[model samples]
Target chain A: MIRLVPRSDTPALLQVATPVMAVLATMIAGGILFAIMGYDPVAAIKTIFWDPLFGLAASYSRPQLLVKAAPLILIASGLAVGFRAGIWNIGAEGQYIIGAITGAAVALAAYPAPEMWIFPAMVIAGAAGGWAWGMIPALLRNWFGASEILVSLMLVYVAQRIAAWMAFGPMRNPEGFGMPGSRNLQQYPAASNPELIAGTGAHWGVVAAAAAVLATWFLMSRHIRGFHIRAAGTAPRAARFAGVRPETLVAFCLGLSGALAGMAGLFEVAGPAGQITDKVGVGYGFTAIIVAFLGRLHPVGILLAGLLLALTYIGGELAQLTMNLPAATVQVFQGMLLFFLLGFDLLTRYRIARRVTA
Target chain B: MIDPIALFLLLLSASTPILFAALGELVVERAGVLNLGVEGMMIMGALSGFATAHYSGNAFLGFAAAALAGALVALPFAILTQFLMSNQVASGLALTLFGLGLAALFGKPVEGVKAPTMAAGPLGLNWIVWLGLAMVPAIWWFLNRSRAGLILRGVGENHDAAHALGYDVRQVRLAAIAFGGAMAGVGGAFISIATVLQWTEGMTAGAGWIALAIVVFSNWTAPGVLAGAWLFGGVTVLQLRLQAAGVRVPVQLLSMAPYLATIIVLVAISARQKFSRRAGGAAPGSLGQDFHALR
Candidate 1:
C-alpha cells in the first residue's frame, strides 16, 4: 500500500518544486476533463498551453498575454507585499474599480481635448483613487477595530455600484445615443494608454508592472521598512519590540496595494478595456488574491505566477471557444490551481504521519 | 390592521441560509477553528444539492447529499490543519478555493437547470425554512445541554487544558468541522431548493462571507445568529420589494444593501465588544489558533 504521509523536513528544492508539481497536476487533470468533454485532449491542451506563445497563433496571442499579465503582475505584486506582512486586504477589486472611475473621470472631463498632460494626470488620479478606497478598511481597522477582510470585501460591492452610477449617470457617452458607458479612451489619444511599442502589446501598465516588481524586490530585500513588515507578520511581539507599529504598517500596506491595484484598473480602462462600465472589475481583484498566493507572496514568485495565471486564463478561453466548453471553466481552473497550490504548500511546513492503534 | 403573519413568514424564508451557515461556523469556531471556507463549502453544497435534486427529483435527498458533499470537502481541511499543524488561515482559504473550483467544474453541466420544487409541507411554508428554524434550537441544545457540546466548547476554550484532562481535542474539533461543513451545505441547498430555485454560477454571491461576519456579529451565540440572519433577510426583502415597487433606486445600490448591512452590523458588534468589558465581553481564548499535541 502506498502511504500518503509527507516526508519530514522538506528541502528547499521541494519548496520550489511543489508549485511546479501542482501546475503539472492541474494540466493532467484539465487534459482529462477535456477528453471527457469529447474534445481531442492533446490538441486542446496544446492550444491552451503551447499555442499562445509558440503555435501558429503566437503572433496575436503573445501580445495579448503581455496585455493581460501586466495588470495581474502589478496588482499581485502589491498584494503579495501586504500578504507577507500578515495584513489581509481582500478588497483590491473595489480599489481597481475606484481607480478606473477616477482615472476615467479625469479623461472624460478632458474629452475632445488633445492635451499632453491628460494621461499623467489620470495615472495620479488612478493611484490616489485606489489609495483612498483602500484607506476605508485601514482606518476602520485602526479606529473601530473592525475586521479588515469584511470591510474590504464589502467595499467591492460599493465600488461596483459606484461604477454603475458613473457609467449610467455622469460619464455616460452622449455620442452613443444613451449607452451606459463613457467615451472610449482610445478615441482620445491624449488619455489612451497606447502600446509603447507598435506591435509588442507593451503599454505603460506593463512598464509599471515591471518597475513595481524590481522596486518591491529591493524594498523586501534591503529596506528597513520591508524587514519590519516581515518581522511583524512572523512575530508580532518581536516586531513591536523592533519599533514596528502595527497600525501604521496596516495602513501603509493597504494603501500601497490599493494604489497598485487602482493603477492596474486605470491602465486597463484606458488601454485594453477602453471605457468605464459596470464590468470594469471582471473579478481581477479576487483573482489577484490567487496570484499573490501562487506566487508564494514573493515579488519574483508573483511575476512568474502572474504570467502563469494569465496563461491559464487565455488558455481557458481558447479551450472554451475551440472545444465547446463553458466560459466559467477558466474560473474553475484558476480556482483549482490555487486549491492545489495551497494543499501542496502544506508539505513545506509540516509532515504527515499515521500511527497504529495499540 | 398590519399583515404581520405574511411579513414574518417572508423574513423566515429569507433568513434560513444565513441562520444555517452562521450556526455552523459558530460551532466550528467554538471548537477553536476559524474556517473561512464557509462560502466555498456553501457553494459546493448548493451545486451538489442542485445536482442531486435534478437527478433524484427529491429535495430531501438533495439536502442530505449537500451535507455529505460539504463534509467530504471539509474532511481534508480537518486533516491538514488539525492533524498536521498547518496554518489555519491559509488552509481554510485553500479549502474554499478548492471547493469553489470543484463546485464550478461539477456545476458546469447543471447550469441553467431549474431545481426540483421544494413543497410546503403542511404549513404553507417551505420545509427547508422550518428545518432552518429547528436547527437553531438543536444547535443551542447541543452546545448547552449535551456532553459532546461541553467537550466541543472545552476544546475551543483551551485545547491544551482539554487535552490534559484526557479529552480528545483533535477529535472534537474534527467532528465540529464536519458538522460545520454539513450545516454550510444545508445552507447552500436552501439557496437552490427554496430561494433561487435554479442553479447559476456564483449564485451564493458572498452569502457565505456574510455568514462569517454574522458569526462575529452574533458574538458566538445561537440566537444571535438567528437575529442577524433575520436582519439581513429583512434588508434583502426590502430591497426586492423596492425594486418591485418601481422606486427608481439604482438596481446596483439596491443589490448592495445586504453587504452594506453586514458592514454596519460588523461595526456595531465590534464596537459593542470593545466597549462592554463587563457584559458579553470575552472571546474564545483559542480562537483561530491551531492545536498541536506532541506525542
Candidate 2:
C-alpha cells in the first residue's frame, strides 16, 4: 500500500525544481511520441528546441521570438493576478476578439485620415470593450451565483461568431476586391503599432508586456491588494472576515484581466495581424492559460515562461517547414507540460511512503 | 412547405451527440467530479471512431473503439485528480488540451476520408440515436430508484460522511468518470459516423462545450438533459432551414443562437437559485473538489 502524508512546509527548492522537472519530462514524452509517429525523434526534438536559437536562421527567428511572446506575456501577466485571487477568467480569448474589433472600429471609422490621436484613442476603446465583455460574467457571478468558468468559456464562442460576422459584414474591406477582412492597419501610419527598434522586433506591445510584468510584480509583492488576493486564495473565510469583499475582487480581477487581454488584441490588430478577420483569434488566449500555470502564477516567472513558450512556437513552425512535423505536435507538447507540472506538484505537498503489511 | 416529421427527425439526429455527452456529464457531476475535458474526449472519439470505421469498415466496432478511447483518455484525469490530489479545474483543462492535440496529431491520417454507414433502425433512425433516446429514462431510473445510484449520490453529497459510512468514495467516483467518458465517446462517434459521415480535423467543434452547457441547463437531472439537447437541436435545425431557404440572416449570427440561449438559460437558472429561499436546485456538494482518502 502507498500512503501520501501532507507536508507542513514546502521547500523553495522544490518549488523551482518541479517546473524544470515537468519540462524535462515533457521533452522525453514528446520525443517518444515523435518516434511512434515514425519521425526521427532526436532530430525532431532538436529541430523544435535547438534550431530556433542556434540554427542557420537563428538571427531572423530570434527577433521573431519577441513578436510572438509579447501578446502571451501581456495576457498571462493579467491572468496570473486573477488566478492568485482564486478568480478564473478563462474567456480572455473572447475579450481579445472584442478588443480587436472595437479598437479597429476606431481606425475604420476614421479611415484615410492622418490623425495623431487615433492609436491611443483606440487603445482606450479596446480596453473598455474587453472590460464590458468581461463584466458580463463577473456581474453574473456576483449577483446570480453563476459559475464564471462556464460563462466565460461560452462567451468565447459568441465572440468568435461576432468576429466572423464583422469580417463578412460590417468590417469587410471595400477596395480590395471583396476580401473578408478590414483594411490593413499597418498601412495607416497614425494607427499602426510599429517596431520601436530596427531589428529587435520590439513593438509597443513588447514595451507594454515588460511594463505589465513589473507592475504585476509590484502589485503582488508590495501592495495590500496583493496581500488580500493571496489571502482570498488561501482562505476565503478569513479574507471575508478581514473585510475583503468577494464581489469587488471578482469585478477587479475580471475587469483587469479583460482590459489587459483587450490591449493585447489591439496591439496585435494594429501590428502583426494588421487586420480584423474571422481568424484573428489564433489560440493565444488559450495558450496564455498554460503560460500562467507554467509560470507558477508569478510575474518574473511569467516573463521567462512566455519567452520559452514563444521559443516553442517559432521552433514548431521551423520544424514544420524543414522536418515535415505536424502542426499539432507543439500543442501536444504544451498540454503534456501542464499535465506533468500538475502531476509533479504532488511532490511538493506530500511525502509518499510505502505501507508495511502487518 | 416544410415537413414537420423530417425536421423532427433532423432534430433527433442533431441532438444525439449533446444528449449522450450531457447525460454522461450529468452522472459524473452527480458523483462529485467535474471533468471539464468533455470537449477533448468528444474530439478524440470523433477522430478515433472515424478512423476505425474507415479502416475496419464496421461502424459499430468504431463506436466501441471510441468508447474505449474516451475512457482510456479520461484515466489520466482520474489519476491526476483522484490519486495525485491535483486541482480538478486545472487538471481538467489540461486533459482538454492534451486530448485535442493528440487527436489532431493522429487525425491527420483520416482527414477527408468517408465514414462507413451503419444499418438503419426503426423510423430510419440510427441505432445510436435510439440508444441515446433510451438512456434518459434508464439513467433517470438508475439515479432515482436504484440502490447503487443512492450510494453514488451519497458519495457526491458528502464524501467524508460517505467515507465514514464505509462507502469507497474513490471507487464510486472513478466508476462515474469512466462511464461519463464512455458516453461522451459514443456521442462523438455518432457525430462522425452517423451524421457527418466524414472525418475532419476538430470536427466536433464546440459540441462538447454545448453539452457542458446543456448539463447545467438540465439542473443535473437526466430528463432535463434531454430537453436541453432538444432545445439546442431545434435551434440548429431551424437555422439550417433558414439558411437553406435563402433567408438574409448572416449565417455566423444564426450559429450564435444556441450558445446565446445557453447563456441566458444558465443566467436564469442561476438567478433563480440565488434569489429563492429554498435553493433547492443545488449542484452536487463536492462537485469540483478533489478527494484524498488518507487513513
Q: Candidate 2 recovers what fraction of true contacts?
A: 0.72
Model 1, A150-202: lDDT tens digits are 89988988899899888888889999799899999988899999899987899
Clashing residue pairs for model 2:
none
Residue B215 CA displacement from its true place in model 1, Å: 0.1
Best by TM-score: 2
Candidate number achieving the greatest DockQ relative to the actual structure: 2
TM-score of model 2's chain A: 0.97
Model 2 lDDT at residue A12: 93
How many residue pairs clash per model? 0, 0
User: Least accurate stretch of 10 residues (summed lDDT) in model 1 chain A?
Assistant: A1-10
Looking at model 1, the pairs that clash are none
